[model samples]
Target: MIACLRLFSALCLAALLAACASSPSSSLGELPRTPDATIEQLLEQATSAKTPEHAALLRLSAADMAFQQNNPARSAQILAQVPLDSLKPAAQIFASTLTAELAMGRNQPKAALAALSHPSLQNLKELPPEQQIRTGTVHARAYEADGQTLAAARERVAMAPLLTGDAAASNHEAIWSLIAAVPGEQLQASGNPVLDGWITLAQAIKNAGTLEQQQAAIDTWRAQNPAHPAAVQLPTPLTRLKELASQPLNKIALLLPQQGPLASVAKALREGFMAAHYQAQQAGQKPPVIEVYDSSRVSSLDEFYKKAQADGVQLVIGPLEKPLVKQLSARPQLPITTLALNYSEGDQAPAQLFQFGLAAEDEAREVSRRARADGLHRAAAMVPKGEWGERVLKAFRQDWEANGGTLIGVEYVDQPVALAQQIADLFKLRQSEGRAKSLQSTVGADVAAQPSRRQDIEFIFLAVTPQQAQQIKPTLNFQYAGDVPVYATSHVFSASGDKNQYNDMNGIMFCETPWLLNTTDPLRNQVTAQWPQANGSLGRLYAMGVDAYRLAPRLGQLKALPDTRIDGLSGNLGMSPSQRIERQMPWAKFVSGQIERLPDTPR
Candidate 1:
C-alpha cells in the first residue's frame, strides 16, 4: 500500500509490456521464489468488512498475493469474482485499475482497455488523484494496441493532470512514447512535470541522431524502464500467421502466352501450376480453381482483366511480356496481388503488380557485393556493345558504384576479347613504367616486384559467352588477368556444357537460377528428363514453367518481399520494399566445362 499525495503526475509509466509478455520463449528458464500468505492479513483490514469496498479490496489483495505466487491465471480469476457493489469510490477505482493490470499481465491489451471502460472504472473523478492517473495511463496502452491512437492520446491528456510522481514515474513516459502518433517531446512536460522534465531532456539525444546516437538512446530508455514491453520483449514475428491454405482462396487469374509462339512452354507452366492444386488436395488444403486466360486468345490484355474481374477473379499472375505487365499493373483489377514476369517499367512499383523476373541489375549487385567482401576493391569491365551487352555493362557500373568499388575503365568488345591481347593492352602502360624505372630500382627486385597497381586489379567483369569466357579466361593464366578474379552473367551459364569449348573457364564466376541446376525433386527430374538426351538446357525453362504454376496463387507471398530479399525458383532472393523480387547471381565457376563452385561461393 503505497501512499500518494503528490504535486506532479507519475508521467513516466512503462507500457508496451503487453507486446513483450506474449512473445513465446522456447524454454521456461526456472521457477520463481514462493511466498507465504497469511489469512490474518485479509482480516486485519475488515472495517465495514461486509461492504463492497471492503470485499473488493480484500479480493484485490488476495489476487495480488496469488500473482506474487506465480499464478497469474488464478489471480485474474480471483479479481473477476470480487464484488464491486460494496466498493467505496477509492476502492472501486483501485479495483478497476487492478483489473486492467491483470489483463496486461495476461497479455490481453484489448481486454485491459475494455475493462477500463467500465462505468465504475471510467468514473475516475471520484477516486484519489494518483489512483485515477495510474488507471488511465494503463488504459491508454490498451487503446494503442487496438489501433485507436486517438483514444490513447486522449486518455494521456485527460489523465496527465491527475498523476503525482513516485518510483513509477519512469514507467509512464515509456508507455506514452509507444502509443504516441507523434513524438511527445513537447507535451510530456505537462504531465507529472517532474518525470516530464526527464523525458524532455531525453528528446535532445533522440531527434534524428546518428546510428550510434540512436542506439545509445535506446539503451538509456531500456535501463530506465527495464520492464517496459519493447525493452524486455521484442516484436518478434509469429511465423504461424495462418498460411493461405487455411484461408478462402481469392480468385486468381492465370495469364500466360499459352497459345502463341511460346504455347508449348506456356502449357508446360500451366500444368506445373495444376500440379500445385493436386499437391494442395493431397495435403488436405483448399485448392484454388484457376481460370487460365491465354494472352494469345485475347486481342487486348485489358479485356483479360475485365473478364476476370467480372467473373470475380481477385488476383492475376503472368503475361511475361513487359508491356502487358505495365498495362495490367497501372490500374489493378482487384484488391489482389498481381505478379509480373518482367521488371517494372519505371521506378514507381505498381501497388497492384510486382516483378518476378531474374533481373539483370540484381545479378550485378550480387557480383559486386561478393567482390568487395573478397577484398577486390578495384575492377574493370570488358563488355559487349549491344542492347543485352550494354545492359549488363550498365548493371556492372551501377553495382560497382553503389557498393563503393571503382571501375577503372570499361572496354567494349563485340567479339570474345583476345584474352592475352586485352590483358597486355591494359597492363602494357604499367609495365612500361617498370621498364623506365629499371635504373632507379634493382632490376631483380623490379622483376620480383609485382607493381602495387597490378595487385589492385582485384577482379575483372567480362560480358561474353561461355565459349568466350572459357577461351579468354584461361589465357590469363600466363598473363596479368590470371592473377585477378573474373565475373560474368547467365549468358556464360547458357553454354551447352561443351567440355572442350569451356576448357578454359575453370575459374570464372557467373549468376544462374535454381532451375539451371537439376534438383532431385521428382517433378524437376520428370520435366527435364530428356535434357540429358538432347544435351540441351531447354529443360530448365520447362521446369520454370512448372514451378511458376505451383507458386502462382502464392504470388502474394512470393514476389512480395519487403526488402531486396526474395526467395524464388532461382535462389535465395532479395525484394524491394514494394514487394518486387530481387534475385542474386548464384556464383559458379566452370569446373571442367561442367559448372563447379569456387571455394567461397556456396555449393
Candidate 2:
C-alpha cells in the first residue's frame, strides 16, 4: 500500500505539472482538461491488472484518486473492491485506514469506526509515526462527527507529542480549534491536565494586553507544568503578542456626562472601569493613567479632544450619548485614538475610532443567532409599540433572515389587549375561531369545537420590558400557543434580584452577561456589594464599562487576530474587520420564578 500510494502521488504530480505547462498562457476558456478523465482511465487499467496484489494496489490507488476528485461515494465504492485479506500486514492497515477515511467522508461515522475496529488495526503504536498520526486524526474526526467533542479533543492531544515541525504546528492548531469548540465548563471538567493547561493558557493569552502580562502568563504556565507539550509551543503565539504589545499608549482620557441627567449612569460606568483598574493593580500590573473628562461641561468635542491631545493623552474613551459618538466619529482626523461608547448612525465610521456599547441591536442580533442554533428556524416577533421596539425588531429580522431563518410575522403593541390580539393574529387563532363558528352553525346545539394555533412557527422573538413580557407570556399560554418556545433580548429580565416578579416569565429564554447570573464570581460579588442599587440597564452598562477598560489596550491585538476572543465580564468579545466588537453572552432561561443559566454552546 505504501508503494502504491507513492506511485499514485507521483502520477498526480506529473499530471498537475503537465496541466500547468499546457495552460501556461491559455485563455479562460482554453484551459487544460480536468484529471477526472485521467482518473477514469486509471480505474479501467486497475480492473484489468493481471496479478492479484497489483489489482489490489490499483483498486486502492483508484479509491484515493476518486477521493481527490471530490467524489467520496465513488471513493468508497472503489475502496470496497480492494481485497484486504491479500495485502501485506502494513498494506492491510493502510487499506483499512483509507477505507475508514472514505466512510467518514460519506458521513457514515459508524462505518468508519467499524472499519478501524479490526484487531490488526487496533494497536496504532505498531504503525509508523506518520501513519499513527493520520489514523488518530481520522479517529478524532469520527468522534467529532459522533458529537463526542471531549473524546475527539483527547484523541488529538494523545497524538500531540509525536508530531514535529510543520506537522506539529498543524496538529496544535487543529487541537486548539477542537478544544475551543468545547464549552469552558466541559474543558475544565475534562480531567486531563494537558488539556486543562492549554485552555488556561488560551484564556490567559486572550486576556493579556501587554508583553509583560503575556510573558508572565507563559512563565506561570511553565512553572506549573514544566514538562507539558504546550510549554514548548508557547513561542508561536508569544511572537504575535510581542508585536501587538509593542505599540505605545501611556495615558487614557475618559469623557462622560458627570453632572447632568445621565450622571448616575456615568457614575456607574466610572465605578466599573475603576474596578477593572483596581483589579489590575491588585495583580501587580501597572496600567496606563486614566483621567475623567465631563462631556456635559465641555463646550465642544473638538476642543476637548484637542485639549486631550495637548495633555499627551494617548487614548480617549467616552461620550456616552449617541449624538456625541456620532459627532466624534465624523471628525476627519483625530489626533489620538478614541473608543466611542456608542456606535454612529451610519455604517461607515472614521479611522482611529472604535465603538463599544450595550447596544440593543447587538442583543437582538444575538437572540436571532441563539434561536437559530437551538433549531428554531421560523420565528414570530412581538415588540413593544415604539421606536426602541422597532429598532430591536428590525435588527432581529435582518440577522435572522441573513442566517437562513424565516420571519413568520412581526407585531408591535404596548397594551395587553393589543398584544393578545397580535398573538392571536400571529397564530391564526381568529381563523380557528371562524372554523369553530362555522361548525357550530352547521351542526346541532350539542356539538363541541376546539381551536388550534399555527404549527409553522417554531419560536417567538420578543422585544419588550419586564412588565410587558410578564403580561405577554401568560397571554401566549392563554391563547393556546404555549408549546412554541419564546426567545427574547436582555430587556425581558430585570437585574433587581426579585425572583417572584418573573414567575410569570417561566419557560422564556434570553441571553445576558455573566455578571447578572453568575453571582459567585468575586468581581461580580464585589460589584454588587459596592452598588446594591444598580439593576436592569444600569447594571449592564456597568459591565460594559468593565469590558471597555479591559479592551482598550487589547484593541490592536484583536484587530491583528480577528478570530481571537476575550472572555469579558460583559460577554465573549470578538473583533470584526470593520472595528466592531461583538459580545457573545451566556444564555439563561426563566424557570419556576427563578433564572437559570443554560449550558454554553458554540456560536
Q: What CA root-mean-square deviation does each model show from the true structure? A: 21.1, 10.2
Clashing residue pair totals per candidate (backbone < 3 A) = 29, 0
Clashes of 2: 0
In model 2, the clashing pairs are: none
TM-score attained by model 1: 0.54
lDDT of each: 0.58, 0.77
Candidate 1 — worst ten consecutive residues by lDDT sum? Answer: 24-33
Off by over 4 Å in 2: 1-243, 535-537
Off by over 4 Å in 1: 1-246, 259-285, 332-336, 417-421, 428-453, 530-536, 550-567, 598-603
lDDT of 2 by residue, 176-288 (tens): 66655554444464678887777776666555655568667767877887877777665444555666566656889988897878898889888899888888888898788
